[model samples]
Target: MTQDGYYAVQLNSIEIPGEFDISFLTRTSNLKAGNIIFDSGTVMTMLDTDVVDELVRELTDFVSLPTEKPVAPHFKLCFAVRSTEQEEELPALWFGFNGQSGNLRVGPDKLFVWVSRFVKCLVITGTNDKVQVFGHITQQNFLVGHDLEKMELSIIEKDCTKLHEP
Candidate 1:
């Protein structure tokens, strides 16, 4: 948690271009410490407008499918997939924290959603607001633990359905 009462974390890096292993961390100043906050109430992750624009650009170039406007007003990027299998064409995206050894890997299942039968959009949106939110969509199926005493947050993927089993 941050001193400002936000559950914020420092984003160390982002892996967007999978095959080339390229990171935009050095290219942008928006990836600053304590810029991202975890918010369970928000259904979709929201980044700064500038950050989202850059991501949209990269994604538009990377994804071979035809692009379209999202049916919803919030989302800025959408793609038309021929079938569920075409979702595999999306490259992997990961968000790494300052001190964490494992990056939060977000696959197509977690990253994209079908707004319509043929159109799928990124689960992330751009916010002109002050705070950038790491929403529940990306945090799905993960057990997130916050240690207020140590001011730390831990996230691990789990089979949520079997969590209550002995």
Candidate 2:
């Protein structure tokens, strides 16, 4: 846990690639590695403002959907989807950490949340100066573990619901 009470991890890079084309966006090469906190208490992921802006711009260009002002104050990008079916075409995101751990590939199901029957908003947002927070929405379906003795964190792909089944 960090001094601020959030469980933070060192991040190496964040990348978003076109689902079917060549356009891509990446934020890496930080002079000092950035910290990304995994916060279960928060509902959406928060990244540095510049990173978020670039990501939003790239996604907007790729999808090209008519935009609507976000009803929620925290959301900056919200699109009007005719149906949930439209979500199938959004771009894919890859989050890479600083160690030997593999990259996390995020699909639309984990990346967006339905605001209403017609609106589905991306769960990622921007922060001004705080370390990035990886919220619960993006952590779904994974079995996460922390080891204080070793000062290590481990995340494994698992069906969390069945963890305690007989």
Q: Pick the candidate with the highest lDDT.
A: 1
Which one wins on TM-score?
A: 1
Q: Model 2 reaches what TM-score against the true structure?
A: 0.81
Q: Model 2 over residues 117-159: C-alpha lDDT tens digits?
A: 7777889998885567788988898777766566566788778
In the range 1-166, model 1's lDDT, one tens digit per residue, is: 5545667777655666443243434433233346678888889998777777877888888889889878988888899888767878866688877665257887777888888888889988888776678899888888888777887888988878899999
Per-model TM against the reference: 0.85, 0.81
Report RMSD (Å) for each prediction in the order shown. 2.9, 3.9
